[model samples]
Target: MRAIVVSEPGGPEVLEWREVPEPRPTRGEVLIEVTAAGVNRADLMQRQGLYPPPPGVSEIPGLECSGVVAEVGEDVEGFAPGDEVCALLAGGGYAERVAVPWEQVLPAPSGVTLAEAAGLPEVVCTVWSNVFMAGRLRRGETLLVHGGASGIGTCAIQMAKAFGSRVVVTAGTPEKIAYCLELGADEAINHREEDFAEKVTADVILDIMGAKYLGRNVSALNTGGRLVVIGLQGGLRGELDLGALMARRGSIISTGLRNRPVADKGVIVRGVLENVWPLVAAGAVLPIVHEVVPMADAARAHRILESGDHIGKVLLAR
Candidate 1:
């Protein structure tokens, strides 16, 4: 087996595809012969030595993958060999094979190819958990999304729209803003020129710009609003306006999926399969893929993502 190894963690150049021992399924897990993997911001962070994998997990820097099930571990049910599936992983997605807990695995969405399904797990789970489950975004309410051109952003826009929520998004350029609107966002704000806080108030704000947008995110919230921060693209430290937050009865939460327990991820995956996957199958929600690069060109994929030029996910395919 071969996987992308971040040798000494610095830049995209640090990633090296090299031979490694193949992984086998353990109890309650399954082995997937990787076909495609989703490249994410977290993978970049890991390459830069910022976000290390949780203890006892793989060092390969990928978080989601789609492949054919090669073997099923003991105690696993409802899945069998040769099933086409996609899975959320703690790590090790940038490889020819990955062993994942059965709970983290899901049947490929009906309308999408197995390769494109690689892009769905992380973004779908993130949006479903943060926007609906944790942030409590309800139908007929307004939801705000940061980085609307991103993999998470694109998925969030469609899912929120499918559930009848008004979606507003922020992006860096005019083209990106237009793309977001095309993907069902009711309004698109160019962050480079406009202050999003002055334009609209939201019932739920899904934020990726942490410190830079913290104060304004609070101001942009409607009464009893929920703000969920899942990325720190801006910075980590930010001062909170407790007075304003208290007055509005707003709540702020920061979460990460990679470090969460397998049991928790299973629950989120189950929710996604039942709720979000249907939207995807029905064409109400779709996986937005920017480009598909070969696994050996993983370094170039990282560069494209870091450049922030792509509109959606850059997938690495076998």
Candidate 2:
């Protein structure tokens, strides 16, 4: 098999496609023939030596992929050879084959092509877990998402709207703001020109710019609001107004999916299959893809993600 290897951690140019040993399924795991892999900011972080895979996981940079089942390990059930599936991986998605725990693998939804399904697992799981399960975004409430045109943001907009929540977002450009509105966001604030804290209050805020937005995010929250920080695009350190947060009875949570135990990921995967996949199948929510690059040119895919010009997911296909 062939896989993308980050040799010595540097720019995207360091990614090399080379022959590698094929992986085999272990107990309770399934082996998949890779189709397409989703490119995420985390992948770039890993390439730059800022993030490393969890112990006993693969070194390849991808976090999610859509593929066909080639074999099932002992104790695996409900999935057979040749099943179309997508999975949330801890690592190793940039290869032609991946071995994943059965719990994190899901049957591809009915409406979208298998290639596009590659973009769903990471975003769907992130949104479902942080925005709904952890953040407790309820129907009729307003949810604010940072990076409105991103893969996670795009999915959040559609999913929140489908569940009867009003969605608001912040973007850096006029084009991005318009695109967010097209995806059902009720309000799109230009972060470059306007202060989001003055524009609206929200019941829940899915924030990615960790430190830069910390103080303002608290100020923008409605009473009893929830702030879930899932990314650190803006740096890691910040001071919070504890008095204000206490007055509003607000809560803050910081989380990530890549380091959780498989049992926990299983719960999130099942939640998505039960609650979110239906919306995808019914056309109420859909995956947004910006472009698909070949796996051999994985460097190009990384470059696209770093450009920040893409409206949605950038994929690497076999």
Candidate 3:
């Protein structure tokens, strides 16, 4: 088997595709022959030696993938050899083969291809869990998404629209903003030119720029707003104003997908399969793929993502 390994962790140049021993299924796990994997910002962080894989996990740097199950470990149920599935992973999706807990796997949605399905797990689970489950966004409310052209942002826009909520988004370029509007964002703000805090207020804000946007994000909130921070592309430290937050009765939360326990991930995965899968199958929401590069060209994929030149998900195909 071959996987993308971080050769000393510095830049996209550090990612190398090399031969490695194939992984086998463990208890309640399934061995998958990966067909495709989604490239994420976290993978870039891993390459830069910022976000290491969880202790005892694979060294490869992918968070989600689509594949065919080659074997099922003892005690795993409802999945067998030859099952076509997509899964959420803590690591190792960059490889041609990986072993993932059965709880994180789901059959490919009825309408999406196997390769495209690879892009769904991470974005879908992240959006569904954060926007709906934690942020508590509901119909008739306004939801704000930062990096609206991103894989998670694109999915968040569509999911909010499907739930009958008004969606607002921030993007760096006009073309990217247009793309988010096409996907269902009611309003698009150019983060480069506009102060989102003054343009509009939201009942919920899904932010990626953590520290840099914290103050403005709090200011942009409507009364009773829920602010969920899922990424820290800007920096780690921020000043919080308790006085302003208290006046609005707002709540701020920060979360990460990796490093979570398997059972916790399972709960989120099950919520996605039951509540979000139908929307995907019906085309109310869909995987937004920017490009699909071969597995061997993963370094190039990482460059595209790190440059922030592409919109939506960049998939690495096996």
Candidate 4:
């Protein structure tokens, strides 16, 4: 088996494809022959030595993947060998084979290909967990998402709209803003040119920039708003005005999926399969892939994701 190995922590050049021992399924796990892996910002962070995989997890960097099941471990009953599936993984999606717990695995949606399905898990699980489950974005209320053209942002826009929520997004480019609008975002703001804090008030805010947008996010919140911060692309430290948040009756939540326990991830995965899967199958939402690079050429995929120019998911296809 071959997987993308980090020679050392640095740039995209650090990612190398090399032969490695094949993984086998363990108790309650499933072994998958990887078809494609979704490239995410977290993978880049891992390559730069910022975020390492959880204990006892693979070193390879990938958060989601789609493939055929090669084998099933003891107690894995919902899946069988040869079943087509996609999984939300903590790590190791960059390899040709990965063993993961069955609870995080989901049957490929009826209308999407295995390659496309690879892009679904991470974005869907993240959006459903943060924007809906944590932020409590309800129908008729506006949901603001930073990085509106990103893989998670694209998925968030469509999923929120499908669930009857009004979606508002902030993107750096006009092209990205237009793309978000086409995906059903009711409002699109160019963060480069406009201050979103003055323009819109939202019931829920899904923010990626941590310290950079903290003040503005609180300012943009509507009464009793939930502000969910899922990524820290911006600087870590930020001055929080608890007075403003209290005045607006707003709350801030910080969450991440990678370090969560298996049972917690399973709960989010089940929610996605039950709720978001139907939207994908019905064409109300889709995995918006920007490009699919070869598995062996994962370095190129990392470059694409780190560029911040590509809209939607970038996949490394085997």
What would the per-residue lDDT of candidate 3 be over residues 34-100, giving only the tens digit for each residue? 9999999999888889889999999999999999999999999789999999999999999999999
In candidate 4, stretches whose alpha carbon ends up further than 4 angstroms from where it belongs are none
Q: Which 10 successive residues of model 2 have the least lDDT summed?
A: 301-310
Model 2: which residue pairs collide?
A: none
Please list the C-alpha lDDT of all candidates, in the order they appear.
0.95, 0.96, 0.93, 0.94
Cand. 2 TM to true fold? 0.99
Predicted candidate 1 versus true structure: per-residue lDDT over 184-266, tens digit per residue: 89999999999999999999999999999999999999999999999988899999999999989999998989889999999
In the order shown, what is each candidate's alpha-carbon RMSD?
Answer: 0.6, 0.6, 0.7, 0.7
After aligning candidate 1 to the native by TM-score, how far in Å is the CA of 25 from where it should be? 0.8
The C-alpha local distance difference test score for the whole of candidate 1 amounts to 0.95
lDDT of 4 by residue, 76-146 (tens): 96999999999999999999999999999999998889899999999999999999899888889999999
Question: Against the hidden reference, what TM-scores do the models get?
Answer: 0.99, 0.99, 0.99, 0.99
The candidate that wins on lDDT is 2
Evaluated at residue 231, the lDDT of candidate 4 is 85
